[model samples]
Target: MTAVWRKSPQDFGDALNIRETVFVKEQGFANEFDETDKTCDHLILYDGEKAVGCARIFPDGEAGWHIGRVAVLPEYRGKGLGARLLCEAEKRVLELGGKMLCLSAQMQAEGFYKKLGYRTVSEPYLDEHCPHVRMEKIL
Candidate 1:
């Protein structure tokens, strides 16, 4: 079985680890870690005792809540863990008084976000050479 646990900013080490694996080492993203990781709450999805996926969420002033740093371990991909991690973040955001969700989805992963109800709201833009689009979903 799999479970998701929330970690406050100070406890985001696990989230950082996964991001390093997915976005840094694998995706060649140099801007993986940022100041936002210090403020957002992280959600780590675990399969049994192993951490498999992660995402971070925080208020977005105009967009309700922002979800970012979404990552899943290579070995854990294709098992729907990413979706579970996202749903958990949404639940926590709602609990934190949010009514909408916003994310900067990588162009390649845009369809995944769309399948989960997010609609692109911006023109494609480059983030460290990888194209991305801002997407939002009313919760």
Candidate 2:
């Protein structure tokens, strides 16, 4: 039950693997990996030696930070790993002097983000063929 969060190059690979399994192969987001990852900071969550979840954060001009590509292995869902990854991402954003955080949450995940204090800022829209809504949280 010990989970660790950290920044590392390996996180990119681990995150991509999870995204591919959940978003691409399963959900069919053909272009899931985009240019944003090039300039953003990624956080990885490990349950013992297994990578269970990950999230990425980037500067959103001066408005604050933008979080993206958050995912957890299917078998790992409902265990709070996603929330833990988000908490770690928010901490990293705050460490960088950010005052707010935003994300385009998949419609199905809006409730989960809401529980984490994120408020919807827009109506649902299509993102990669899936319904998504913009959400934000003020730090």
Candidate 3:
């Protein structure tokens, strides 16, 4: 395992690169980026200056903070980088005065989020071809 650093990137294109690798090319998603990328709080995980993982969080109006687009490069998975990135995002939400966080998690990765204290809040649904469920955790 390698030591990692987290940054609130001035350029979210760094986040996009990881998301594109995990959520787009590897996952076969056509529409990956969205307008929300322009406004959300974006985080990137770095291993000695190389961006390896990322996530984004923001308020959801009536719902609270929503966390999404979390991705870690294939070579960097299983090293606890994902968990560290998410925990940092949770901390970021609290810093932004949020008491809760919600996310739409791909069913295959649902267990990973659950281990971090997120609970499924919605039945499985399809995002394109992938099945996902809504989950939440209170801060």
lDDT of prediction 1: 0.85
Stretches off by above 4 angstroms in model 1 are 1-10
Could you tell me every candidate's TM-score relative to the true structure?
0.92, 0.91, 0.91
Candidate 1 vs candidate 3, TM-score winner: 1
The local distance difference test score of each candidate is: 0.85, 0.84, 0.85
RMSD of each: 1.6, 1.9, 2.6
Off by over 4 Å in 3: 1-10
Candidate 1: deviation at residue 66, Å? 0.3
lDDT of 2 by residue, 52-128 (tens): 78788889979599998898989999898889888888888899999999999999999999999999999999986
The residue-by-residue lDDT of candidate 3 on 12-91, one tens digit each, is 77788998899889999988988787777788887877888888887986647999988999998998988997899888
On the 0 to 100 scale, the lDDT of residue 98 in model 3 is: 86
Position 68, candidate 1: lDDT = 89
The candidate maximizing TM-score is 1
Poorest 10 consecutive residues of model 3 by lDDT?
A: 1-10
Per-residue lDDT of 16 in model 2? 72
Q: Runs in model 2 with CA error above 4 Å?
A: 1-11
What value does the lDDT take at residue 120 in candidate 3? 99
